[model samples]
Target: MTTTRPGGRSARVRSAVLRAAGDMLAEQGFGHLDLAEIGRRAVVGKTTVYRRWGTVAALVADLLDEMAEESLPRTDTGTLLGDLTANARLVADTLTDPRQGPLFAALIASATCDERTAQALHQFYETRVAEWAPCVEQAIARGEVPAGTDPGEVIRAVSAPLYYRLLTTATPPDHTVADRAATAAAVAAERGVYVPAE
Candidate 1:
């Protein structure tokens, strides 16, 4: 027996459609994504997919929003190096994962040509960066870094090289890569690279 309840049904439909969209985005790239196909894959009605998202870009934006919501929070490890290392490793792992690697690449590529997608992608990064920025603030409070150092910049620095390597090369990042990124960012922050002069 099937029951039609507004809240439960709508939420499940959204989840299923987003999952289907994510799978297609990962497997075939965003260029091949289709509303009708996503609806079929999700077992949702085509009209619903069309009515809800209207376009592929909108659907992808929603998927990115969901991804941000589902991403992990930061870890606190008493030391800046430890915390940054954990953050770097998390980014490395996600960018190297079989499904996520391609999915992210596709999204990044899409953002390059589409303004709305770019905004959505930027929002996703902003959310992730904000989640980890507190670790840098904690480090500053601990006298590990200079006062007024930008925590968001420090966090971004830790993950930038890892992401660059992922986008530029076929090789997956190892633990050493994550460690190096964390160390480099920590050293830079210590040297005031992220500190803005008044």
Candidate 2:
């Protein structure tokens, strides 16, 4: 039995392949992705790429999983507003980053056309929202927001407009926009907007 060690050759190959894939996705979008081309760019064997990830959608799914795993842990700022602001700023910074922004745009575009990619994208956001949901839970415990405020909804609200702006407008979301998003979400949560219906 061949066991793959952590940080071993297999790990290196996966890292290289993922990096090459991300570069390609950022540069040319999902339509141009080919396993053979990815193999060439990653300097890995073509067969290996095909064997590991059978389809472009599968490869993209793996990439999204990797991204979720590598994402930063949530910030804890004591106050709900402060924590939400930090979360919004993180999303804004990621969406505005040169390499990551285009890569995400490509992924989101592909998701619209491919069911598997869409599932992967949905899972990515779910992971991100779950990570930040605790902030709202903390707020509830602190009496900052009404009881029964949906933590996940509050977290999603913080990022929704930023993503809308990313998709609909040329202007990238900035810190000021992030601040506004956080504030709005916080105020809404405080007013029971995120609270579940009776």
Candidate 3:
């Protein structure tokens, strides 16, 4: 296996701590997260964790920032449906992932009670939406959708149903469900459902 330096000791420490925090969040939910436990899990000093993050909300915010920074970029597939399908698939995959799925649910639940965490979660989605909004914009340029269609709204539509299913149902969405989401969003956009009022 290839090896690369994880930037030096400080960066390594940050990586370890964040990874521990994410693991804890995934396994036990945010309500059960403990700084001391995370410190022990990361093999870093408790004082270091306290000094760096100071609070669980801060740590969660940092984790979300890291996720936004590390997430995959949007796909460009020449058609709105194709691009939206790729986006929907990515959302489904993340929401159904053994680790990420629970982590996201925990984050969402935490955000409902914590203002800082809620802000962080909103920012995370905003970043992701901005990354994919161009697909809708491209569709407009290609005359595939209404000229005044709201890209962000269309992009969100593609993921909304998948997320709703994840939150409301026991069954995880498969590729067929993802395709349907993409198709629905594409059809809605094509029909001016996302067009903004004058």
Worst 10 residues of 3 by lDDT: 1-10
Query: What is the Cα-based lDDT of residue 55 in candidate 2?
Result: 90
TM value for model 2: 0.96
Model 3 agreement with the true structure over 1-198: per-residue lDDT tens digits: 111224789788888999999999999988999999999999999999998888999889988988988999999999999999999999999999999999998999899999988999999999999999999999999999989999999999998999889889998888899999999999999999999887
- Residue-pair clashes, model 3: 0
Candidate 1 lDDT over residue span 80-131, tens digit each: 9999999999998998888898899999988998887888899999999999
List where candidate 3 sits over 4 angstroms from the true fold.
Answer: 1-7
Provide the lDDT at 188 for model 3: 93
Error of 1 at 43 (Å): 1.2
C-alpha-based local distance difference test score of model 2: 0.93
Ranking by lDDT: 2, 3, 1
- lDDT of predicted model 1: 0.90
Worst lDDT window (10 residues) for model 1? 1-10
Alpha-carbon deviation at 129 in model 3, angstroms: 0.1
TM-score of each: 0.95, 0.96, 0.95
Q: Order of candidates by TM-score, top first?
A: 2, 3, 1
Candidate 1 Cα misplacement greater than 4 A, ranges: 1-6
